[model samples]
Target: MAAIAGCSGSDGGSGGSDGSSDGGDDSSSDGSSDGGGGSSYDGQELNVLTWGGYEGVSQMVEDMGASTNLKLISSDKEGFNTLQGGGASQFDVLVLDNQWAQRNAKADTIVPLRREEYPAAQEGTIIEKFNWPYQTFGFDGEQWAIAPRWGWEGMGYNDDEVELADLESEGYAAIWDGDYKAMAADAPTSVIPLVMQQIFDLDENPMAIEVSDSRLETLEETLVEMFNSVEAVHQGAAALRQAMLEGNAEIVLGVGNFELSQLAAEGFDWAKVIAPPEAGGWFWTEGLCLVNNPDLNRDLANEFINACLSPEGQRSICWDGESKGAPANTAAFDAFSEEEQKTIMMYKDKGFEAADEILSGLDQYLISPQQEQWTEIWERAKARSDL
Candidate 1:
């Protein structure tokens, strides 16, 4: 649980973290922000941050580093308050939330990845297709955060409780429908992303927004209506998996992952898909990011990223061990046995809308403390039985 966090280029004696440089580190060997940050390298002492589900990244990165000059230190923070209070910069590479990557990259909280540093960056994953023109800190012309891992955001129907037909008829509003209503009001932060997406989709959908002003009000009303109709909220994926497996939920929001996919293979019946049939699916690429330290640790950090996407590393750790998900590297995908590839496909989407475009104005992944406060909105929704 603790090991999942990387670096090395130059050797500086100054910018050492006295713990106050929470957001900034000295720049490294390349001298530019690309390979540098704080004033010191501090040996192979790597610090990492990933959400709860990705707890396995530690052993995976450590194994990858076995053949390289890097040793990464990793940690997972479940709630945003930990990041909000500061001290995030105490680590080197951060597997930040995909949405914040765009907002923070420009602010210097996380630095840009040079095209030259990653040979596999382009052909490997969704990152290459997302960027074209480089700006101050982002890849390509638009804003971006980090190279993504695999796409998610599938609709989940709890096999025991909800009927698929009813689930479809109500759309996002279904979470608050019927006996399952108890779970809807208090659902975890994960479900809010789905609600916001539904809101984003409705406001943009031709059917939902034919007229401009009045209809917009109607859409907002519907969103607020659906948002307030919940009774319970549960967060961890393990808990969700347990709920479904034990028959506590008939239908719920589904995100593609090993747990869900494996559960289905073991005879659990469930269905999932991308949201807004009119628009493409949504996915998240979980990859490495520089903490912006320019010290002896620069070169090592660069090496760490390289090893992570390496085909050999991908084959050894991806999905087979604690680390689960499709490999971002093309070679890693190819290296997957037919069975492994098929297992990952249960979650992968072929023609997802370009993340840069979908996230252009309203990227939902950007869950700042204020946005996460949707708990209040949800509580209100639960209070009303119907709009």
Candidate 2:
């Protein structure tokens, strides 16, 4: 594993772009670099490879007036798979799922975060529940990532097409309910197992990749049935949204605010997103981590991350109107206008407390030993989508 340089002290107090340090020589010396053979990103480009989806950091940094050569890339693959495929040196920073912190830290793919040294990395600005290291973003008493955005995944239905009362009674069975045509993401790794876990009252954590062979046998049967009955199980969110808009699907499984909010913004007022009462819900947090790179431009990398954690950065991430989710920066909620807050359902009347209660009752995703088996099963289920 290559040794990474300590983060450059680019907190908001410094001068550069919008009070952010721009990798200048006078920047406070926070940590030491590995002095590796490769040149620093000081005069070169900074490559950022993100997992899951783009988090808007490239634009945010540029907006903050950064002059660093920024190259942002997005990957649909899980963070662990990216690191396993030798992506560590390819990118200087990774905006990834919070769950990958432990595995990546163990693999030495990410550097320990000294949040105390950075002004924008203040944990106090983050939601209280997410501030706990053991609960959200720490391993072995050290920090690895900064939690920024979070949301839940479960189900979405068009109010005009399906009765809420009927869905409440069916719970996880709503996906298989013959009355409504179903469309789901083809990835059974999270989609099918999560719903089945809810159906049989098994583990509620969607991140749990492992399952007992006997349990998987039953899960496979249940998934085959659902896949065969559905109109089509698309591979990504865009396709699933198309299916819903074209009237091919009435219910979508394994969706979250990222999709529902955009759909509503597009005038799908009848769309409603929820976790079945019986299944609770699955929650995930998006975090920013410094990749372990020998040629890392520590100053620029830290500046980019701090910019995202700043109050303004938090507000822009959630209230952008196009992309929507609960900002991990709790203070961002108050900064939003009344209408904007309501748009994301963060208002008093929207049962924000009630929604938070439901999310609290849910379990975080965890790594399970049955991960490989689940992947194989998911592939089989996908093949049977038309069956």
For 77-167, candidate 1 gives per-residue lDDT tens digits of 2212233445444546655444445545544555666666676655445344333222312543543333434434445555345555555
Candidate 2: segments with Cα more than 4 A from true spot: 1-47, 51-65, 76-92, 118-123, 134-136, 203-206, 294-300, 342-355, 381-386
Model 1 Cα displacement at 347 (Å)? 5.1
Task: Write candidate 2's Cα lDDT for 1-387 as tens digits.
Answer: 000010001110000111111121212221211212233332344556542122345555444344333332222134455666787776777765545676678778888888675664454756655664645558778888887666666677777888877777787677876679887765544475456656576644644545567877877777877887777766456666667788888888866555555566666666666676776656666667888988776777786677666667666665563535667666556666655544554222252334466566566644445656666777787676565
Cα deviation at 99, candidate 2, in Å, is 2.5
Per-residue error for 73 in candidate 2, Å, reads 3.5
> lDDT of all the models against the reference?
0.41, 0.57
Residue 350, candidate 2: Cα error in Å is: 2.7
Stretch of 10 with least lDDT, candidate 1: 6-15
Q: Using TM-score as the measure, which candidate wins?
A: 2
